[model samples]
Target: MKHSSAKEVEVRVKRTFLARKKPTNSLIDGQVKISIRFHQLKVRFKQLSVELNLFNNQSSDDRHIRCQRIGTRLHIFILIGSSIILALYSSLTQEIHHETILNPSETQYTTLAQVLGDCVVCPCSTFSVSHETFISIKPIYHHICSGDFVSSAWINFLLRSQFIDFVLYSDYHQQQQQQQQQQQQQQQQQQQQPQQQQQRQQQQQQKPPPPQQQRQQQPQQQRQQKPRQQQQQRRRQQQRQQKPPPQQQQPQQHQQQKQHQQQQVTTTTTTAQSVASAFWSFDNNALELYNSGLDATLSGSPIYTTSFAGYGAAISFTRSSTQYVYITPKVLPFNSRSFTIEAWIYPVSLSSSNDYGIFGQCQATSSNLCLYFIARNNKLLCGFYNNDIQGGTIITMSTWHHVACIYDLTTMTQQVWLDGSLDGSHSASAYNGLWGNTAIGATFQLGSASTFNGYIDNVRFEARAKNSTEILNDATLHVYYSFDGGSLTDNGPNGINATAYGSLSTTTGRVNQALQFSSGPYISYSYTPFYFLGISGSSFTIALWAKPTGSYAQQTILLVEQPSSWCVHYLVMTSTGQLVANCWIGSNIATNGPILSLNTWTHIAYTYSTTNGIRLYINGNQYSTTGSFTFSGSGVPMRFVLGGDRVVRQYM
Candidate 1:
């Protein structure tokens, strides 16, 4: 039989072989069957070869075919070789032609499913191919079947898409990690907060109890226990009251109670006593001046006596002669220890040699007495003349000034305060000396035996046996006046009928009354309208409270005119509410200080010295200037003026 197709040949070979194998088959038949089967096989093989040859002939120059045939020996080998060669050729051709798909399994297939996971079926496994599987199968597909170029293209697209998904996933995972960390930190903080709060509460609870709580507990216990003691005291008192029936004992008890009451009253009165009275002025009436006697002498201006001028007395002497003035009391008191000697004097001349103007002395002999006055070179000398240990320098121009000498025995120290400051001091073993007759002789004159000339007024001697602090605390020299023919009345020395000028009244405190002046002219014949509470030529402070009624043309409060050329004036209200001070030496107002306020009550103070010029203090503020003035020949023998001039009106 002639087989036309390869398919027919294959079929004929199979049928002939099966027919020969039946039961009752002849040798010839079998042989024929075998020959036919062999022929059919040969034919089928020839046809296959022809088809392959034709396929090869179509692309003769193709190296892929040559390679595929060269290695095709066994059937499995031909199968694998042909498949691999075809796949390789397909891949090469697709790549050359720029085809999208070359292989189905591999063929460099890139599909969304394969690159990520194989959603389509994977022929080799029960599960679908995952991204990892796809990656593994990729090289296999390149070496095996060649089909579905689209799968390869899709794989590449899926790989690009997978890269984008991977980036997003990574970002999301990082954000999740950060958020978790933050939450964990917050949780840790929350866990610690309760512990901190508990610690604070424990500290607050452990604080110490308040003072009020402790006090309250103690007081409550005391209050509960006090009632029983009170009840016992009441019972005792009742028993005593029922048994008190002795008349004589009652009288004695009554007298004792009265005496106890008196003692209590006395104690109360003493406790209530004031210290203000301790500073009261001394009794000036107790003092006496001995001017003409064996113990003392009198000289020029003998009219200036303590009897005549209340507290001031003066004695003058010339260069050729000597004079003295002394006081002797009827009773020589022994307790005259702490004393203050204040005097106002003008030195007419200063001696080159040491001069003595004895103020007070208890002298049985000349060398054994205590004395005080200006020494030679114008220094103040004070202490026992026999052995003078304590003294001070008084370097002032020859002029009139007020000087006060205070001696305190309790402290055993002598303090000489100039103006208000301590200028000098001395220490002594004892202040008490032998009591002798107090006297002033020719050697103890005012412008003493050495011819130092001047006038003196307002000499006050106070015996204060107490310490200085005690004496200052107890007594004050309240008032001082030089009665130069003026009535001793409550109204001041400037008379009531006087014009614009006013006067000091005695009705006020015992001290010297302040005189005020208005803006009109008031004249008087007697220049010494009010006695001048004079001062000696030394360091001194002049202070007074003054109020001006109106502005004045010329208002003079105090003036000093010397015999030769020295003059000083304290003028107030020369201008409205203004104070003027002028110091003249040798007929020239060498220094004219600035004026201060006068409208209101003002305390005006002037501290003057020959070495320090003049310092003015208004209400405690100091005033300074450049000009200097000095008394040249002798000190001024001038009287103080309240509202007018000393000698005459318009004396300036």
Candidate 2:
């Protein structure tokens, strides 16, 4: 039993040992796995240490050295990229700064430094410039630049005492007046004679037929009478049949007729006096319109007719009639060494045998000693006593022509101008007054020498000779507007001004600068002082250049309104793009002209007269009238509205 017990114990111990040994083997496997993991971790740490050596120490192994080289290359690439990016950013900043400094207003640019051989770079401020700085200019011009010829005194002397003579009356007009008065007086005498005869007859009948004759008649009446009543009735019937009946007129009608005749006479006389006085312009001293001359008297039978310019009247003379304008000699200083004579003439007929005179001043004794402007051989001839300067251009008949003769004593030159051009020029000797004095106080008259037949107008005489520019200006210029001065200023003889309203800008134009209209812009001008534009005047011309942006129902380009009438005249653009000129008299009178294209410049002109009606021109060519119209308005134009009307707002 003891031996068995011992054996069992040993077995148990072996079993226990075996179990412990099995567990120890499993633990050893786990230890090996942990060692392998630790080994792998150590290798990774070594690799990290190698990467750190790029900034620290060198490597020896070839593979380690290759790894180091790759790492070093990546580091160098990153440094190069960062440097390039920084350089690019700095360059971009500099360029942006440079561009910002350069773009701004002229006054805002200020120079800090500059090189003599290169353009100076400037910096600009963002502030706005003042309006005065933009408009004002400081000129570096000297006063000496303006020569003495432009002096006020010199200009005044050149244009002083200018005169425009209108020959409007003659003896025929006066004789007609006198004949009308005589006829009126004769009619009055005839009317009074009949009335006086009727009054005498009535008095004779009312005086009881004289008492002696009445008594004898009564005895005869009693012898023939059947009864008193029957005898009276027979006598009354015989008296009515024997006496002549008197012509009768109602008393109220006669008084009214007499009053009407008196009113007619007063009206005629007042009109005649007013017309005569209108031609006479006087100063404070009652001096003539021309400071250098006096009033002239009409002679013969010159009549007033339509003028060459078609605006006013001219003097017409017949070939056989002794019609002329007589000026008191010595009133005009024709004795001046330098003088200019100019006139517009229309010759009707020229005589081959005689010279027709436009103006003549002859000596009291000798007709040869004359300073006469005459038409000889169908050409202008200016005579200074013995010397005569003849024009080259032939004088055409019927048509209007401008003739001027100038005597410049300073240059000893004589010039003849036709139609504002120099027709002839000649050297002349100075004239010595005849009989040791001026040949004044003699026969001095226009159209007096020999015979003159035709029309004459705007006869002018200047103490100084005019230049070619002046002559051309007189012939061609009326009013001119150049909108380049930033304002609507007139560069013409008449210094008219215009006012602008609303959004009116300027742009490139057919001329230097053109007016641009937007947001209901317009220009206005008064017509008070313009006589040619008077509403009572029958002739007028309007010209304008326009560029339309769009068409509208009714766009008023020009509007002439009166205080009495709302719109006396208007030039409008219709929805159909046609230009229409309308005038209101008792009714509407309108003329439709050419169509206006959008966004294009066009020139338009309209002329009106009672005789010619309405004439519209487009771009220098006459357009076919779409409608014919006439104007008989008598209201005075108050103002001219351009680009719009008083109510309707039209943009252009």
Q: In the order shown, what is each candidate's alpha-carbon RMSD? A: 51.6, 42.6
TM-score for predicted model 1 compared with the true structure: 0.33
TM-scores, all models, native as reference: 0.33, 0.36
Which candidate ranks first by lDDT, i.e. highest?
2
lDDT of 2: 0.60
Task: Extract clashing residue pairs from model 2.
Answer: none
Instruction: List the global CA lDDT of all models.
Output: 0.44, 0.60
lDDT of 1 by residue, 1-652 (tens): 3546877988899999877666575876788789889999999998765445312435556686665444443455678889999998888883422222212444333464456453343322322233223211111122122356457676665433221111001223345666887999999999999999999999999996788886877778689769978998999999888876687578788779968965644432212110100111111221333221222334442333231123223444343454445443221222224556555455556665756463544422233233544445565555554434333556455444455456665666555443233455776434333233343322332212432345444444555433344333222222233222333322321121222234422212113333323333333223222222233334445665555444444567655543244445655445443456655445534334445443455556666576766677666687654244443323222434445321111111
lDDT of 2 by residue, 390-479 (tens): 888888888667778888878988888888888888888754322111211112323234656887766666667889998876554445
RMSD (Cα, Å) of model 2? 42.6
